[model samples]
Target: MNPLPTACKDEVVLTLPTILLPGLGIPASAWNNVKAHVPNAYATDRLDSHSPLSLEGQVNRVIEFMDDRDIDQAQLVAHSMASFIGEAACRLHPERFTRLILVDGSYEERRKACLRIPIEKLIPHATLRAIVQEWRCYSFWANELREIQRSHPLRTRTVVIAAYACRPGRWVRKLRRQAQQLSALFVPMKGSHRLMLDRPEAIAALIREDPPQAQRHDGYAL
Candidate 1:
């Protein structure tokens, strides 16, 4: 395992994780391929069992973590629901972010709309089962994993990779509601959902191409 640099005292660059999933999944480890290209990158440590059930809570946690880590500014790359949090942070404090790469970002409005319907509501339950199921075959994650891939079909290489790391279950409805509020605030990524792991190469190239710029104090929502 590559240890995070200990003495980032002069300047520390942080990489925050996506919501409702661990770093081992989706964007966290997947981003390792492009780490060498980044100047300074440290994955946000797991927040206190406080999974991002809502965008605000997630963003707040991230902000607090940055304060704790003394990360004054950063280039954010968020996948899935976590993308919304990153956007919120940037909007809340423009000077905090150098640049943002929202991959496969599921906006608050869309996610709530998805949960409002009868079938998509299963996502919460599915997420729950996936997390607690002892037998992998019995896990709710398998079905949800299959559904996400089916709903947002991507290249086979990406599909295979995502399926391998899925840990599906139900996210808290309260959290889902928080995510919905974000719909009014930010624009959704191209794929509508699941963009990062699904299109790692593309997103990585985008991040690599856009060199970090000094952040301006003017707060703007994106």
Candidate 2:
């Protein structure tokens, strides 16, 4: 791994290795701008290699990447649907997480709304299930995950970079609220959901900024 340069802005010293995860169907180049600014951060499109159809499989792949890098502990920066995979990893093995950055992680509500329509009427149940791995899968829709999140300390911060006319505003608000309750400092950015593509410099600048860390006395949240 290349050494990360000292971030220009005055902030807490960063020593943890940073692992960046891409969104579903997103290429590693998507993180180019952000990674360019964060010298120490590593980017991978490993998930894109297989074009895996399920989010849980994406989560497992992240673990494998961590193992390959000997990353017992590192910060996770997840954008778009990648938040689902990153969140799952953090939940399953909080010991490996020093922090998590949720970039554009509020698209779940829109997903749910889209999945609400009865596609089963148009397609066979098995076909619909195979096609829509996100909605019907227990990996995403599990109430247990929600229950765990309700009281658990996230032990991290949130950076939300939203694009113009981003639908499902309510879900974003909910995420913001949850971040606050966890005592995390949230930094909000505006541009497009494709912030990495449209405003890579700005996204990189934000990634370079330090978000507020939560105070915790217990072990990992998991």
Candidate 3:
């Protein structure tokens, strides 16, 4: 793969390594297509699938993974639930991440602490085992979402890509407003929630594109 170009005038040839984080329950192989396009990219395996960990623990694991590989800083590309982990990790340790790309990320209101639903019971038996194994992950995700709601806006350069199918909806609008507040570039792409899997080449192309203009509030056209 060719080295990714920067948007700077000096045309720096150094390409920052990329970290691809999959959503909850998604296998590392899900990022295979995108990984194939970026030779320097590393796709992380599911962090809490087997032995469950708290959200903070997952963030620590991500940092440790990078540190173990001697990666000082890299572009973080996260999808769905992993977006929460990426955002939190970046906020906690801003120096470890150069940029953040949230692909069809989930943005919801802070979860109620007292409201505990039997998620495993609600799902079918076939998926019950997986849910049982991932119950802690689910809990951590909800708690993390609440924390993110009360957290400060991100200072790192950020890009948010929402699915076109979810356009003209309240969720997308909310995400747009959040992006504006963070001065992040928001892009609406033609795909489903699983946009990366649906259009890996397109996703990879966007990842390879130059970073968004710093402190820009306007959204980008496809």
On lDDT, the candidate that comes out on top is 3
The predicted structure with the larger TM-score, 1 or 3, is 3
Model 2 lDDT per residue over 1-222, tens place = 323346455754545677887765566777877777666677877422233545556667787887897777777888776676666667666788766777776444332322344454565555334345444433343343454566554555544443444343665567667556546544444456766777666555555553321221012120
- Rank by lDDT (best first): 3, 2, 1
Error of 3 at 12 (Å): 7.9
TM-score of each: 0.44, 0.64, 0.76
Clashing pairs in 2: 163-192
Q: Assess each prediction's global lDDT (C-alpha) against the native.
A: 0.40, 0.58, 0.72
Residue lDDT tens for model 1, 1-222 = 122342345964433322222232243455554554444555553323234444445567777766776777666666544444555555655666655554444323222112212333444555443322212212222233334434432211110011112332232233233334333212222332444445444445455443321111012112
Instruction: Judge candidate 1 at residue 17 and give its lDDT.
Output: 25
State how far residue 55 of model 3 sits from its true place (Å): 1.2
Give the Cα RMSD of candidate 3. 5.2
Clashing pairs in 3: none
Compared with the true structure, model 3 gives a TM-score of 0.76
Q: Go through the candidates in order and give the clash count of each.
A: 12, 1, 0
Top model number, TM-score: 3
Error of 1 at 45 (Å): 5.5
